[model samples]
Target: MMRASLPLRRGMPTSVLGSVSANLARPSSVLAAPSASKFTSLQSNKAPSNLSKRFYSSKTPNEIASEAQADFDPHAITAMDKQSPPEPGADFNVVIVGAGNINFGSDEGPWNHSFRLEHKLGPRLKVVGLIDPSADRAEKVLDVKRKSFVLSAYKDTIVYPTFADYVRNRDPAKPPHAFWVGSPPAFRGREESGRDLEKALVEAFPNAGIFIEKPVSTGPVDEAFAIAERLKSAGNIVSVGYMLRYLKVVQKMKQILEENNLKVMATNARYIMAYEHTAKLDWWDKSQTCGPIVEQATHFCDLSRYFGGEVDLDSVLAHSLEHFEPAGHLRRVPVPEETIAPEQRIPRITCATWKYTSGAVGSLTHAVALHGYNYSTELDIIADGHSLRLVDPYNAPVLYFRRPGDDHEEVVRYQSDDPFFSEVSNLIDNIELGPGSAPILSSYEDAVKTYALTWQIRNRSEEQVRKLGKGPANF
Candidate 1:
């Protein structure tokens, strides 16, 4: 089994503020002064009372709004207009940014997992450039032919050896047509690195379609909105890496919901990976990498909303725990003796509840305390007359329909192929098709929604911890 640990690499200073570091000074006036009247009713009625008892017993509405505006601007929305659909088979050059494990050949990485998909895409979609802070790593992963363009170091593209100059000097006729950002979450005490890479991409390649990894924002929500806004203003295609959206099982689940004319009542998702699989990296700690909510549960939140078919998030309550006493004969991994102080450690367990605008409810539970390589995601959708269930990350998702007269279950399987290809292909098509067409499977807007929900859960959970005068284990 692959262990999840932060690798210690000696090179860049940890504190260097990259181009995309959180810049809280430039506030969005719109988010700062949202229409309070429009949200008064919802705020008063749906706000979690437990949160008030624990964290905000004496806070005023204005104070809460101010704090929220600092993290996220409810009013910010992408302004990119959908363009006219392109002819089928139109070719485009793509520049892949961030040679992290997800995008490139890391030890047992997903990038290599998607190789068959890349082969399927063929010559039309060429990998024009590869970007990563580590030149050697990038070179090893992106070993292009002699005639192919392979820029090793990130700074090499400009005057300081940056991507800017490379793009400028490249044939304007073939400027990178698209951009794929497969970097990890800006956790691992490398928040600035993630931000810098994003800023560089935005400034250097404004015209390319941009795809970012999941949990789009690792720190302040406002920073994420700002980045999204910049991309929107630049007329860039920003698609987040919520791979489940493209999964055959999930697609079939969507079809099931539409076919039954059902409305979601409640949803639940659980993710369990071995602690060893996660604790390998330094950034795996909660304060840096984000709790399971932002790091992993974000996927569940997004998929729930996707299946629920709603946009407005009403409220959230969350709790977490970092240590567990082994029970029975269960063995426990010994905590590292050289581990950082307790506060910086990631939680082993997390639970959160979401009340959506559509009157449906959602809950998520995830833990790294499990003993084996186990990953299970189940969504329970309850409607007026029946309930539907979806299970598994891959195809052959089992579906159970419970109706008044009869109870039956059916398994829907997708043809044997790479789910990533399906999603990437759809993204390319969406980029070419422009906006207003059958909306892209997942959009930047969806990314923002998932990110916001994850942020609220983590923030709210932290508030609970602070109010209780205890650490993460209390939850």
Candidate 2:
């Protein structure tokens, strides 16, 4: 049946990246600009007296990558360019759950999630169908000329309004092997919740593997945990889109730590995003995008857990500056009047402190109000006699390491490595290799712990804001 596909609205890109590097010892430059300390001192009651009216000069991701390329090995770059051909009659057929621009290509061209997946998997993977309510979105993705690289790669792909609709109408001889949930973070009450969509898909495809986006749930820990439990009970292949875990540099960092048996003592990380560049207002609202911590900052939070071990919920401390300045002075991105409650909006700047189960003290400072496009996503670790840092894991990701007695730090660059390729390829391996063989980087259950920490930070920050009773006047 030739049914009309539903049209869905699209949002701006909020890219997430994690840092990793390897070296016994080498010379180093400062990983990134010295961590901005002023964000932590900003108070809700008082406007930032030193706020810079000008946006910081953006260090374009391409520019950063160019610099990093100068340091990388040509052989590594050449190896990453090679794509392995798929064997005949592979059964890893998949379907996408969203048809927005990010699912196909962004404003800049075919560099979005789906494009990366298609290009990386090549013949090894096949996108047999898509599930979205937006007919416009469906129409857009199918327009081969616009996204020729992505659309042309697929031999044939069907479209449906819902997962159930796709499941019901699918050809029994060629059922979908897995689902890639590309929709935004959704909740129970609101229909756009990705979590709700996943539920329906799981109910329809009992043994299907699912690849989900981050901030798995917009609700509390209980809801997130429930989703994790359901997936576990079904014996489903579940992988959360935490791509940093698959970065070669990150893997090397893990190997270095384990090989040397270095104990992590302390960790510091931050995800300072460009708020002014966020054209959409919903992204700033906690009720919509789940705030930066859950929405975007979770990458670094997960990295903290990846290196520092499990977090101690009892020891978490957090704070935020929801309304950075007087409402009159703020540059507001217009949103539907009264669509989101004032109390539900999250702060532009937030900071949280916690203790890992391993006794390592750690902190994460997330700010979305930066003036530049150069995102600051970094993690620093202090272990036994060494200090290691992963800088700007998103754009031009670099790694730096130094020991107690070293005068120079060792550095490794990954300006050319595509972590997403590594992530998608691993997901494919997991589906084909079954249990114990494939290394599923960030499983749904493990990602839930990261989601829990984000909620804990938000809850803690809210409690502090309540005690201060110094709400911003803009609202």
Reference-based TM-score, model 1:
0.71
User: How does each model score on lDDT?
Assistant: 0.49, 0.58
Backbone clashes in candidate 1 total 23
Per-residue lDDT of candidate 1, residues 24-110 (tens digit)? 110100101112242222112222233222222343222322232222211222111222222336456666654444554445323
Could you give candidate 2's per-residue lDDT for residues 1-475 as a string of tens digits? 0010001122532211111010101001001111123112111212111221011122322223223332332223312356655455554578876665545654432224666666556655667777666555575667763356444446577776665567678877767677776655442211224335556667778877887766565544555556665676788787776777666677666656766778888889977665444445555455445556666677788888878876777799998876643531336444542455676566777889998767899999987555544556779988888888998665566789886789699997755677666656666666777753445667776776777777678767867877787664433
lDDT score for candidate 1 against the true structure: 0.49
TM-score, every prediction: 0.71, 0.77
Candidate 2 Cα deviation (angstroms), residue 31: 33
